[model samples]
Target: MSDTTTNGAADAAQAPQIKMNVLAQFIRDMSFENILAQKGTGGETQPDVQVQVNLDARKRTPDHQFEVVMKLKVDSKAKGSGDQLFLMELEYGGVFHIENVPDEQIHPFLLIECPRMLFPFVRRIVADVTRDGGFPPLNLETIDFVSLYRNEMMRRQAATVPADDSASA
Candidate 1:
């Protein structure tokens, strides 16, 4: 090939094209605590487990890319004494390079696939935290990301709708 043609090909290859891929996947931060241990030592009763899950998503850039992060906090307490037994928090995220994808594709990527990718790790953390706390290892039930996402959207929509007051008036 001629020098000019070869140079043109090189330029094309180096051009910043929209390539979609997960750049990094990991637990950005994690915390697990055995709260009951602070109260006393030895022969403590099993605590009631309470789990709280929070879901959030935001665009990292105005362009066709985003970051979806799921934060889960679990707290277990002794029912009678209200003494905390275990506390765990997991922050997980996936960096998605989304470009030129249609609107339909975006929802599934953010709401469904992203959470699915992060769940196993979150599950493992929960189980380990309980086991480490000296309780039987807790197994978290599987989460339905699609249903959760849809319910969230519905709740937001419902909140925005103005209630009819004529009946009360």
Candidate 2:
């Protein structure tokens, strides 16, 4: 029993603890074009919006520090008339300090976890930009980062298979 207790303590001591912090966040680029304002509207129109998301990450000069960027493209159209309403593109970036994560997991962690931490800010910016552009505030739904990461991985795998097959032939 004493040996078991000592082994458990040793295991606990040997386990690595994860530490993470958001060092900074900023909008790397942003653009908004209000098409409705450019083209005169005749009557009330309902808005239909579509949003696309992409993520990128890179290591910084400082040890354990990384930069993650979330890119968003939003396009809106009139539901009834099918006329273009507005378009917005934003690149939001965050600087993060992370320690003690296993090397194998760092890729997914940067793509999923880092973006998860920065999502709320991205949502807020989308809402504010839409409202300021003369449309109703557009609230974004919560994104599933894990699903996104999985889909991206699958896409990358699919893209590489053909190249690998060609090389072998």
Candidate 3:
């Protein structure tokens, strides 16, 4: 064979075969705190709690790898006294292997499927943390990941749309 053809074949053979495999899957780390529950006494003071949930995901590399983390913060206080009763924060995350997927497919898997897969674990962590913190288990509301991701993409696209006749043309 000609040198050019031989070189082409060799390059193809050396090319890294990209196959996505879950090299490892586990909770890298976790933290849950309930300082208020520890400090105050159990009373019939009708406590009120405000809870906030934040979700975020990021790609660790250009290849098939990503991390999805969910965070929950709950602030509780006595209804009348306004004294802090309990504060709990739970942070949980998961690592995913996503390889050989085209750019178009990557977004869906990263935004939708990865979060869906990680949600149950994160939810469980929240519940367990709250229970351990001497409060009723926190059952998180179910998330519609696909819709959430699509809405985010649409919002971003809308924000970047050129604003004027000149730009449009």
Model 1 Cα displacement at 107 (Å)?
3.5
User: lDDT: which candidate is best?
Assistant: 2
> Against the true structure, what is each candidate's TM-score?
0.71, 0.93, 0.61
lDDT of each: 0.75, 0.95, 0.71
Better of 1 and 2 by lDDT: 2
RMSD of 1: 8.5
In model 3, how large is the Cα lDDT of residue 109? 72
Ten-residue region with minimum lDDT total, candidate 3:
20-29
The predicted structure with the larger TM-score, 1 or 2, is: 2
Error of 2 at 117 (Å): 0.6
In candidate 2, what residue range of length 10 has the lowest lDDT sum? 38-47
Candidate 1 has what TM-score? 0.71
Lowest summed lDDT window (length 10), candidate 1: 160-169
TM-score of candidate 2 relative to the true fold: 0.93
Residues 89-109, candidate 1: write the lDDT tens digits. 888877777665567767766
* Per-residue lDDT of model 3, residues 98-150, tens digit only: 76667777767766776677778777877787787777777778878888778
Task: Write one digit per residue (lDDT tens) for candidate 2, span 1-169.
Answer: 9999999999999998899999999999999999998887645688888999999999999999999999999999989888999999999999999999999999999999999999999999999999998888899999999999999999999999999999999
Ranking by lDDT, best first?
2, 1, 3
List all candidate RMSDs to the true structure.
8.5, 1.6, 8.8
